[model samples]
Target: MNKAIKVLAGLLVAQLLVILALQTNKPGTTQVAAQPLISVNLNTVDTLRIDDSDGGQVTLRKEGDRWQITNYGNQPADQNKVAELLQKLSDIEVRWPVASSAAAAERFEVAEGSAQKTLTFQTGDRVIDSLFMGTSPSYRRIHVRANGSDDIYQVELAQHDIPANPESWMDKTVLEFEGDILSVNAGDIAVSRDTNGDETSWKLAGSATDSTDPTLINTWVKRFNSLVVSALVPAQEVEPIIVQNPALTAHLSSDKGDADYAFYTANEKYYVKRFGSSALYEIASYQAKPIVEIEAKKFMLNTSDAEPPQ
Candidate 1:
């Protein structure tokens, strides 16, 4: 009986040990992650050129204290986008080396693929690093190949997050003169400041002032503040495709200068041509709808406020 009890105790001890061993060896519990695929001093990289196999090449240059998107023109590049790209390039380390042979690179999409984009990092004229990036192998991973070598590696990153196109890097704020927009004549509807001072606000002008509803002018101002384009119309295509007469025109005057945004409609989408940019900007529908069809009664001063808030 005592021998039987001893054997049962031995079996229970073995079962406990097995459970402990299984728990210790579980995935991610005892593993160290792999090292980075590529390493570089991000500060040393002053200029970045991304030549996409898809189409246009984007060139970014750090000028003075700001980064300039210098393809079609030298305007400020979106800093958030530029900063994220640099950080990813500096931090990406290899998941595993996929291929060493040049022929093997095509299978991994690091070479001879239409989707491949080459990122060239430079300090002054000296090349810091040049790498070819391909499509994602899986979620949160990208395939890469270094210059002057055939070694390809799959690294952790979303391939689609980085935009290789030149126009995508541009600051989209093409027209931001809403504060300076003294008056606008959209078809027959017009809005303007009734008086000239800091305390003065917008009201219906010419013939729209039938009532005292402030909602109309307030809604127009709200939309005007956020007026920006989907993308910069490319430089080469600017002159040929642009149109003069717009469906709506907003004549704006600022302390700096006089600027205007003329809105044109094609196939139901609203496009705007500003004074400075040769490129026609597609107007966001949320902003365009209110101004295009806003009624005159909307500019009225509130009855409660007009009565002098008792």
Candidate 2:
């Protein structure tokens, strides 16, 4: 009985020792926190480059507080979208590495040259940081590897969140105007609104014999109130489009200022250029139809059809 008791006590001690050893060296129980995958300060970042495996690329540069899509004719970038991307880069914390071996990297698509997407951040000419992202282990979780490290981690960023298309970063509403519209002139179609009145009244350029349809005029004028373009045409590509006689030309005066717009069509695609803007804006056919196809006769009231002005 005494020998059996000692043997049982020895076995219990060995089991306790093994448990303590495992508790000390557990995989993720270290006191030190996991280092961040991306550690560059966003304020110092002035340029961003995104490249995808499919040969698509986009570049954005910071000028003052505004961001511009440098590859897309220096067009203004969507500030909110840029801010969100920067915030995501700064916020991603690496809890644990899903992989670190070279073979593992190749299997996960995060190997040095095998990554699906590469994001590079730069300050002036120096690259501040870069990351290679590939393969979604799950929804919103992307396998990422930092520039100088072999350890690849699955982070909470989606692959589509960083688009390689320049248009995805451009501000589509850059041409949208604000303030009260004062007057509009388009060849024979001219209209002006009363600026100093509680109720706004519009006067057409033609005589009473050529009275205008208020609804049609109002509808045509409102298109400018909140114009949104579908895509941006680079300045180099727009020269031929602009040099030719435009299909339609219109000038507008607002409380804020005055501006002119020229519309054109090439290969069945519609385009518009604001007189002072550096680039041409591509608009949808539906958006251009009502404005470009407008005729003075269409807006003029058919008084002959009226019942003798009863």
Candidate 3:
């Protein structure tokens, strides 16, 4: 009787030990099946590679507050555009088929040793990124590397199915030149002459200035307003002034002159004076000729122009 009791006690102790061992081993299996290896977090990455369908590739890196294309030795990159792409990638939720089934194997190619290329991403101690299974015939694939891993992405080119109206974005404001002429900032001058007896030409000057004169200020303000109110004309309206006599192009100018005008007609070149009461005088192209034309027409009309109101 005693021997039988001892045997029974030993069997019970052995069964308890076996149950504890099983419990401990169960946790390992649950952890292994909990998450996938390829999941990625898009926000913290500082570098990325983007490939297009045409076999072109771009690599970008973050510098200061901007992202630049570092693959070409530090070129500027469009950060806003890149951010939009990253957001799209993180939000994608793929519906992968079940493992081992024919449908799953065919759609995702998840089997080991598959032909498709896989993308990997790592940072410090974490791995994050995405994978591309097949090539998109029309669109190209882009690779992004952040932290320590690589991520693959696909991009498509937009089609021009809709026509765009070029004039839609133009400002329509108009300015009346009848008001006081503001200070004009003249740029470099080019002199030429025409064959005909009459001489006429055009000059370009930076329209911006710091003057506060009521008349000058009002004129520019109106001009800027007109530009905001009017649509720009097509390019066909531009016409070139004719140059005739090279001798007529001689003129004199002061470096400190407030305003400078290049006057040329079909036959002569004149450097006209601007600023002070004497500004109305036109400097003769030849030393023998006296000053001519006081206060020539100060303003010209533009049939087609546009700008924002001041």
Best by lDDT: 2
Model 1 TM-score on a 0 to 1 scale: 0.69
Ten consecutive residues with minimal summed lDDT in candidate 3? 157-166
TM-score of 2: 0.81
Ten-residue region with minimum lDDT total, candidate 1: 301-310
Question: lDDT (0-100) at residue 145 of candidate 3?
Answer: 20
lDDT of 3 at 110: 27
RMSD of each: 6.9, 6.6, 19.8
- What are the per-residue Cα lDDT tens digits for candidate 3 across 1-310? 9999999999999999999889878755543232222356555776664332234445566676676655443544445566665565555443322233434433443222341333333343343453434333354432222222222223332211100221221111111113223233222222222223121222223222221122322333233112221222222321222123222222222223222223333234333222221211222334112212211112223212222112
* lDDT of candidate 1 over 168-257, digit per residue (tens): 787777566645455655666666664363324666666444454444465565565567766665566555445445667776554455
The residue ranges of model 2 lying beyond 4 angstroms of the native Cα positions read: 1-35, 197-200, 207-216, 234-236, 296-310
- Which residue runs of candidate 3 sit more than 4 Å off their true CA positions? 1-38, 52-54, 98-130, 133-186, 189-299, 302-310
Residues 22-65, candidate 2: write the lDDT tens digits. 99899887775777678888889999999998988999999999
Clashing pairs in 2: none
Candidate 1 residues lying further than 4 Å off, grouped into runs, are: 1-36, 94-99, 112-115, 148-151, 178-188, 192-202, 206-210, 234-243, 253-258, 266-269, 284-286, 295-310
lDDT of each: 0.68, 0.83, 0.34
Q: Candidate 2 at residue 96, lDDT?
A: 73
Please provide TM-scores, in order, for all candidate models, with all chains considered together: 0.69, 0.81, 0.31
